[model samples]
Target: MTLGTHGEAGLERGRVDLQRYGHALMGTYGEPMRVLARGEGSWVWDADGNRYLDLLGGIAVNALGHAHPAWVAAIAHQAATLAQASNFFATEPQIRLAERLLELAHAPHGSRVFLCNSGTEANEAAFKMARKTGKRTVIALEGGFHGRSMGALSMTHKDAIRAPFAPLLDTVVFVPRDDEAALRAAATEHAADLAAIIVEPIQGESGVRPLAQGFLAAARELTRRYDALLIMDEVQTGVARTGAWFAHQLYGIQPDVMTLAKGLGGGFPVGAVLAFGERVGSLLAKGDHGTTFGGNALAAAAANATLDVIEAEHLLDHAKAVGEHLRAGLEALDGVVEVRGAGLMLGVGLAAPVSAQVAQAAVAAGFIVNPPSPDTIRLVPALTLTTAEADLFIAWMAEHGTRITTEGTTA
Candidate 1:
């Protein structure tokens, strides 16, 4: 169907679409802010025909931005050739994608990849791998977000979300992020039963807070000492989102296991669990785990194309440069206190608890961003976001920053 047509017709279409959406869908997400119709590089148009700079990049899923030509072509070609073949048989794209991931990750010999369809599924697989260790305890960080599924939610630290799902796995322990002492203490206490210590290199949901280098080193050391796995949840920070191919690479630490999604598929739905070394690779035996559509030809082709485009377009360097540009701009804004994170994954800290207001104002002014916390605005825009696009948001913030924050306070 034609979407984003201009004028009152578009407005009417949007309204009708929203009404239908409300009636047909679950309210788990409350309400979608807009009926986005179509998208291109760094921008999207709603059903109402309003254009917006998509700085959120579908929450960092669109690594190549919306509708990248190469990514689209790969998917199209693969779909025509072969899309799905159950786990009973594997395809060339699937095998090649796994090899590519191992090479990009610099995984050691005997390393393996388990492909899946989303971040939660990848985390779930990791959880099972941890369980396969014959140990019961896992140490996770406070304010960390793994995913919404039962297995992932158990390891997640959010109380509100977990409260409803009472009786989550009790063996998991929570430690404060970057608190090396607490982490060491927990590791020592749970040494015998410790299966793994899962962490996000940068806590995306908790305001893009990166784990201290020393703390990550400590986790690595402790996990080794206790013979437990170190799982880095790079779902939000992998695939060149953080300038580096993976955030852990920046710290010079390698995880025994790494979970990836988001940008891996570059807008297509795909996830992966990389098990380092032969020992970790054999954690899940045949019949231990399976998926119907994971790493299907189409998904693998999309991901391969994404990695290809990222390299060909030199997006790693571009992300770093544009990210620095955006960070400086955000930090220079009137109400912005600081900017945290690397590459396109940024959190704009505000002087007041008005990030929600700022995000609202941003969208109204034709930019799209999100407030992960009351005082932090998250910007996980596409790797393709240009300095020109970033400057537009920056300029708008410069003009309206103080007013939006003030209005939020008065309201």
Candidate 2:
């Protein structure tokens, strides 16, 4: 199949690909909505050559958007030069990536970075770090999602996903989101055994819900008082996605440990754990943890390239301005109740529980969005997305919002 092929031949190819996908892949994600063939910037083309604006940005992973020139060139260069090296050896890209992350994070002296392959792995490492404190209990907020791996899953709050995998790490406790009193009470009750408190500054899975400043302040104070680590899971909100380098920076709170992925590698798979100071940095000593493909040359090159592009292009300010434009546009629509979140990460709150239907209609209208909850439509578009591109979606919503919300379909 050629890159720009279309028409009847393309449609037939798409049908065959979907059939193959059904037969060859697991049912974990049910079925993909479309057989995507290629992407550039904020747009993706299906196998049938139909294009759609990718508002979800691979669920907040593609910070530079798809097939970015610099990102692609960097990966190609690294792959040709030196792709992999075992943990026994260290490569330049790997070391440089770690240094860059620490520098970008403004880590104090003795801070450290541990690079891994996915958000789950980063959180799993974090779970071990908490356990290293010789404590057994950890606190996570209700409606918060860490990752799908066993250890990360243990920290997640949803019952449906967790119930299937019984006998998880029983040491973790859940608290209501943004409820300072509950968090304080939980910390006090478990102070003796509290290893850490893991939180998402803005909970992405439940909806783009930001934790209140006061709530975050309380968590910081309580953790300090209890001598427990404050772990920030910035897997979705990190890497300039929220206009800030990290979401916690927005509130002027620094966590002892921070987990990052998604946009870190732009589209390549990479995750990292940033230890803030000497105390937390030394938790995972030599041989305490390890990974095969964690910070290999190729992955590090990709991540470094992603960070480079974000800085050179001034994407941080771009995200902030475009995000505000989107928020204002959505809020002006008839069916929208409000807009939540910061930067390019936003949730359009609807006046009715019709987000699923609206999202479906959006795809039909050549846009891609996600309904994380029935009342919220998530927009985590590429940081490079322009205001003009955003207006296209805003226009669509303005034209179809009334019918989709009330009638459950655009047609």
Candidate 3:
């Protein structure tokens, strides 16, 4: 955690950037934390040249870690060859990436892909697709996070985010997460007119709670019975974040529609909707939905490179093993309450509501973490994280566990 003095000059420069950033940028993200200078693998350096282990992975966006060679090469090559093309004419990377994504999703040949720039846009497209089914009702899990766009925001469960925008889209019902009974009851009540049921295979924002396998299966059954589409919002749990290509695969359930973003492009902004059905492609006709930069060459190339490196390096197996190590080590910490979630997307519970303090303490101790709520600390570190790094974080927790729970809040 010791910051060397040699980079003091660079740190001052970072301060200048922070000052300019504050004045020029919008306050939607609140105050700046540290001006990050550079990163590689699982580590990042700040403006003051302080080093820290990035445990959050840019909120689960940096799948291959920063400055990965394959990602860098792919971006550079695509930028040089073809940055973007008119949507009227498809680029090779775009076509290739779409085909690759379908294969990864285990989707059949007739399945299709709708690319976009972010998770919110992907959900918006999905929402429109659902409406095209001629059904008026939709179901979403409470506390589930779809996106910030109007339609996606309407399906989200948090009141704090929804209060400012009271009039969200209507007829979107809510069911308790992981509760099969409530989900079934809602389906029974609205099955006749339901368009779709949007569910996160594992609810990431709600403290890493995964829906039960039975619940996911039941959703499929109900949707099939009522002729409704099943939408798996895998924006956070996709791209091997859960040790599988997608979390729904673990449950062995096939959704009609799947939305992806966070890790899809290896830190680049990209989102996609994977629709798989005999007639899926025909639902959204031309001009029914589109984005100017959705399937650009550069982003698709980044995504292709990310997928390429993941398979080449066997990061999926690595994520599984390291996640098990982290789970067991975190549970061994004295004041730790529980460890939830799959693979690298973990949530560490504390004996007290001091997750904020523990996160701050972690920052001072040279680690980056997220305190999404009061009692739970979310860890979505890069899949590239190694067991040694996991062990280092475990040692850090073991050394500072009790203090983190007790003294963390005060600071």
lDDT for residue 392 in candidate 2, whole number 0-100: 89
Worst 10 residues of 1 by lDDT: 1-10
Report the C-alpha lDDT of model 3 over 147-235, residue by residue, as the tens digit.
88899999899989998998988889999887899999999999789999999988878788888888889999999999999999999
* Window of ten residues with lowest summed lDDT in model 2: 1-10
lDDT of each residue in 278-343, candidate 2, tens digit only: 989999999999999999999999999999999999999999999999999999888888999999
Candidate 1, residues 1-411, lDDT tens digits: the string is: 111233454478778898999999999998787889999998899887888899999999999999999999999998899999888898999999999999999999999999999999999999999999999899999999999999999999999999998899999999999999999999999999999999999999989898899999999999999999999999999999999999999999999999999999999999999999999999999999988889888999999999999999999999999999999987877778889999999998888888878787677667789999988989999999999988888887777765576455322
TM-score between candidate 1 and the true structure: 0.97
- For model 2, name the residue pairs that clash: none
**Count of clashes, each model:** 0, 0, 0
Candidate 3 regions with alpha-carbon error over 4 angstroms: 1-14, 406-411
Candidate 3 backbone collisions, by pair = none
Error of 3 at 389 (Å): 1.1
lDDT of each: 0.91, 0.93, 0.88
Backbone collision tally, model 1: 0
